[model samples]
Target: MTQYRNVILLALAQACFLATSMTMVTFAGLAGIAAAPDPKYATLPVTLSIVSTALTTAPMSIIMQRTSRRFGFRLGAAIGVLSALMMTYAVYSGSFILLCVGALMVGPFQSSAQYYRFAAAESVPADKSSRAISFVLIGGLVASFFVPTLWRFFGDLFEGVDYMGAFVFAAVVVACVFIPVAFLRPLEEAFDVGSDNAKEEDARPMGAIVRQPGFIVAVVNAALGYAMMSFVMTATPLAMEICRIGEASPEVIQQHVIAMFLPSLFTGFLIQRFGLFSILLVGHMAFAVAFMTALSGIEVMHFSVALIALGLGWNFCFVGGTTLLTRVHTQAEKGRVQGLNEFLVFSTTGVASFAAGLILNLYGWQTVNQAAFVMLVIASAITLVWGMAGQLRARRGRL
Candidate 1:
C-alpha cells in the first residue's frame, strides 16, 4: 500500500510537471513568434527549453544518485516555481529574450520530472516495472486535459496579454506540485546506490553497455521516436495556421497531447504480453500510419488523425525503450545509463524541434511529414535487425 501510494503521489507530481511543460508546448512557439526578432526564429524558445533539458539531464541524474529521490524532486519543484515566475514576467515584460531564458530555466525542472518513471520503477517489483512506468506516465493524460483547459480559462485573464495569464496559471499549478512531492516516501529497499557491498563485477562500463544490441535498440527507439514526434508536434500549430486552420490549432494540439499519453493506460500491459520488441514494431507502424495520413490530405481532420497516430507511436516507443533499458543495465549503473539515455533522447528532440520551424518555413507541411517518415524508417530498420541478431544469439545459447 505504501508503495502504491508513492507511485500515486509521483503520478500527481508528474501531472503537475507535465502541465507546466505541455502548456509551454501549447503556447511557446506562438508566443515566440510574437516576441522573436525574426519570424524564422519563432520556435527558438521551445527548442531552447528542450536543449536545456538535454543539457541538464546528466546533472539531475547525478544529483538524484547522490541524494534521495524526494530531495531531487523537491529541488525540481522549487525550480519549477521559479521558472513559472520567470515565465510570467517574461510574457508581461514582452521580452522575447526573457521568454527564451525562462524556457531555458524550465529545462532542469522537466528533466527532473522525467525521473518520475524511474522512481516509480524503484517502488515496485522488477517484473512489474513496466506497468509502474506506464502508470506514472498515465498522469500525462490528465495533464493533457488540464493544461489546455487551464490555458483556455486563464489564458485571457490579463485581457490585453493572454499569455501572461497562462504563464501565471502555470506558475500556480507548478507551485501546487511541491506539496505532493514533499510528502513522497520512496521504497528504500529498491535503491542500491550507497551500499558499501555493492558489487563492481556485475556492472559494465558505459561503452560496453551502449554497444549492447539491446541498449542501442532502446536508445534508438527512444531518441528517434521522441525526435520525430517533437518535429511534427512543434510544427503542427504553425502548419495549421499556414493552412488557414489556425482556429482549431489549440484543440488539435490538445488531442495530440492526449493521444501521446492515452496509450499509457495499456501500453505496459501490451509490452508485457507482446514483448518490448513487438510493441516497438507496432509503434513504428503507428508512425507509418501517421505519415501516410499526413500525406493523404491537408484538411483539419487529416492533421488531427496524423498527430493522434504520431502520439500513439511516441507512447509505445518511449515506454518500450525505457523498459528495454532497464534490462540492459544493473542497479549501480542506472544513474549514468538513464542520464545518458535522456541526454541523447532530448538532444535529438531539441535538434528536431529547432529544425521544425525552419523546415516548415522553408519547405512546407508535407516536407515535415516526409522528414518524420524518413526517421521512422531508419529507426524501425535498425531495431528490427538488432532484434533478429539477439534472437539468433539466444538460440545459440539454448542449443
Candidate 2:
C-alpha cells in the first residue's frame, strides 16, 4: 500500500479502538453512581487509566521495538477488551478495588494507542509528517462524536445502569480492532529492535541536548504544553463535580475532549496554510481564550466552553510542537530521542495527574487555573524566545 493510504487506514482503526476504550473508561459522569457515598473518589477509574499509561509507556514502546506494530497493537486491543469485561464484572460485583485493577489495565492499552499517531507520522513523506499526525488525531475528533454521545446512549441502554452498558459497548469496539490489524501493512519503523545506534544517539548526555537551543525549545514546548494542559484539564472534572454545577462531569469532559480533538480536523490544513511555528501561536492564543472562558464566571456553561477551548488549544500546541521537534533529530536518534522525549513528557503529566487531587484539595478551582496559566506563560515564552534567536542567527549568517 502507498504510505498515505496506510496512514489513513491505521488512523481510522486506531480511532475506533480509542472510541470504545475511551467511552468505557470515562465513567465518572454517571449521576447515580457519582452521588454514591464517596463522591470524591468518583474519578479514580479515569485516573487509573491515565496513571497506568504514564508508568508503562516506556516499556510498552520498548516492547513494540522488539515486535512489530501489528502484534503490539493487537495485543493492546485484546487487553482492552478483557479490561472492559473485568470492569463490567467489577461493577456488577460491586468491587471497587477490582474496578481499579481493570482501570489499571486500560493504561497499557492507552500507551499502545500513542503508537498509532507516531507510526502514522513516520510512514509519510517528511513534508507531510505534520499532516499525518493531524490525521491520526482526527480519529480523536470522531471520538468526540462517539464518547459523550455513546456515554448517554449506552447509559440508558439498560435501565438503572450507571456505566455497565458503556463497558459492554466498549468491549465490542475493542474487539473490532483486530479487523483493521488483519489488513494493516506493517510500515517500517526505526524504533524497532536491534536499534543500538538509535539508543546511543538518544542517550546523548542530557546536558548536550539541554544546551542545544533547538532541542531545549522543542522538548520544552511539547512537554510543558502537555503538562500544563493536563494540570488544568485533569482538575476540571473534579472542580465541576465539587462545585455541583453538573451531574455529568464525565459527559462534559467527553465534550471538552472532543473539542480538543476536533481541531485536529483543521490543524493540518492550517499548518499547510501557515507555518508550523505560526500555528503554535494560534494554539497559545486559544489556550488563553480557554482559560479566560473557564474562569469567566465559574458557571457550567462558561466552564464547558472554556474547557473545550483548552482541549483544542492543547491539541494544536502539542501536535504542532511534536511535529516540529521530529525535524530536529535524525533517524539514528529516533528511538532514544523519542523515548527520552516521551519519558519526560509523560513524567511531567504523571506528576500533574498525581498532584491534581492534592492541589485541588489545597486550593480552589480558580487557584488551579491560575497555576496552569502561569505554566502556560512560561511555555509560550520559550517558543517565542527560540523563534527570535533562530531568526537572529540566520540574519547573522547571511551577513
Candidate 3:
C-alpha cells in the first residue's frame, strides 16, 4: 500500500476532478435550458463540453508524454479553474453562447483527468494494474456522494442567481486538484526522449499497433461502451424534463453517478476472478437491461433503475477494456496507443452526446435507447469473436 502512494494522490486528484464534473453534469443541462433560445438545444452545452474533451484528448496525451504528468495535470487544473469561472459568469449572465464556450474550454481539463486511471496503471506492476485503476476510480465514488451536498451549500450562497454559486463551487473544487497533483511522484515508466531504453523500445507504426486483435477488442469495448453510455446519459435530463420530473433529475443523476463508481470497490477483483471477456459480456448484458427498463416506462423508478444499470454497464466495460488495452502496448507505445484510444473513445462520446439531444428532440426517448442497440451489437460481436479466437489458440497450444 505504501508503494501505492502515487496512486492514492492520483485518486485524490481524480476525486477533485469528478466533483467538478458531477456539478456540471447535474446542472449544465438545466442551465442550458435556461439559457438556450430553444428547448431543443438544451443539451448543447453538455455536448460541446464532450466535444472539447474529444478534441483535446490526444493532444493532452502527447503533451503529457513530452512533459511530466505532474506538469500536464497542473496545467489541466488551471484550465479547469478558468473554465469554471467562465461557466459561473455564463450562468450569471444567462448567456447560452458563453455557456457553450465555457463548456468547450472544459475539454482540456477533462482530457487530462481521463488519464488518471492510466497513470495509476503505469505506476504499479502489471498484475496490480487493474486494482490500481479501480482504486483511482474510487475517487468518483467519493465525489458522487459528496458533490451534491457541496452544490446545495454553494447553490444557496447567491440568492438571486440560480446556479451561479454552484459554478463557483466547481471552480474551487477544480482548483483543489492542484493539491494532490503537487505531490504526484514521477511514474516508473516516465518517458525520457533521449534514453537508450526509450530508443530500444521503438514504437511500431500507428496502423500496425491498432491492427492487433487485442487493441481492436479493447477499443471496441471501451469506445462503443462509452458512446452508448454518453448517448443515454446526455439525454436523461431532457427525458426527465419531458416527463415533468425535472426536479427529480438531480437525485436520479446522483444515483446513476453512485452506481457508476460504487462497483469500483470490487470490480477489479471481479475481473481477476471472472476473467476479462466474462466481465465485458456481463457489461453488455447490463446495457441491454438498461435499455429494456428505460423502454418499459417513464416513471422515476424506471429512470432510476435504467440509469443504475447504465452506470454498472459503463464501469464493467470501461475497466475491463482499459485493462485489456494495457496488455497490447509496450512502454514506448504507451503515448501513441493511449492517445489514439482516448481520441477514438471521446470522439465517439462527443458524437453520441450531440446526437442525443437531436435524437431525443426529433424521434423521442425510445429512439435514443433504440439507436444505442447498433453500437452494442457491434461491441458484443467483436468481443465474442475475440474471446473465441483466444480459446481456440489456447486449445491448439495444448495439442
TM-score leader: 1
Candidate 3 stretches greater than 4 Å from native: 1-8, 62-67, 117-133, 182-202, 396-399
Model 1: clashing residue pairs?
none
At residue 91, give the lDDT of candidate 2. 68
C-alpha root-mean-square deviation, candidate 2: 3.8
* RMSD in angstroms between candidate 1 and the native structure over all alpha carbons: 2.9
- Lowest-scoring 10 consecutive residues by lDDT in candidate 1? 186-195
lDDT of 2 by residue, 1-399 (tens): 468777877777777766864564345323213433454454456566776787777777777777777777877888888888887777666777777788778877788887887778767878888788778777666665656666667668854656687777777777877876666665433254444445463455656655776777777777877777777766676677678864566666777778767777777678889877788878888888888877777777877788777777788888787777677676666656677778788777756654655577676777777777887898789889987877798899999
Which should have the higher TM-score, number 1 or number 3? 1
**Which sections of candidate 1 miss by over 4 Å?**
1-3, 65-67, 121-133, 186-198, 390-399
How many steric clashes between backbone atoms does each model show? 0, 1, 0
Q: Which TM-score value belongs to model 1?
A: 0.89
Local distance difference test scores for all models: 0.83, 0.71, 0.86
Badly placed stretches (over 4 Å) of model 2 are 1-9, 28-44, 118-134, 186-204, 245-251, 265-277, 395-399
Write candidate 3's Cα lDDT for 135-203 as tens digits: 898877777777777777887887589878779998998998888777666652345433355543488
TM-score each candidate. Answer: 0.89, 0.82, 0.89
* Stronger candidate by TM-score (1 vs 2): 1
lDDT score of model 1? 0.83
Name the TM-score of candidate 2. Answer: 0.82
lDDT of 2: 0.71
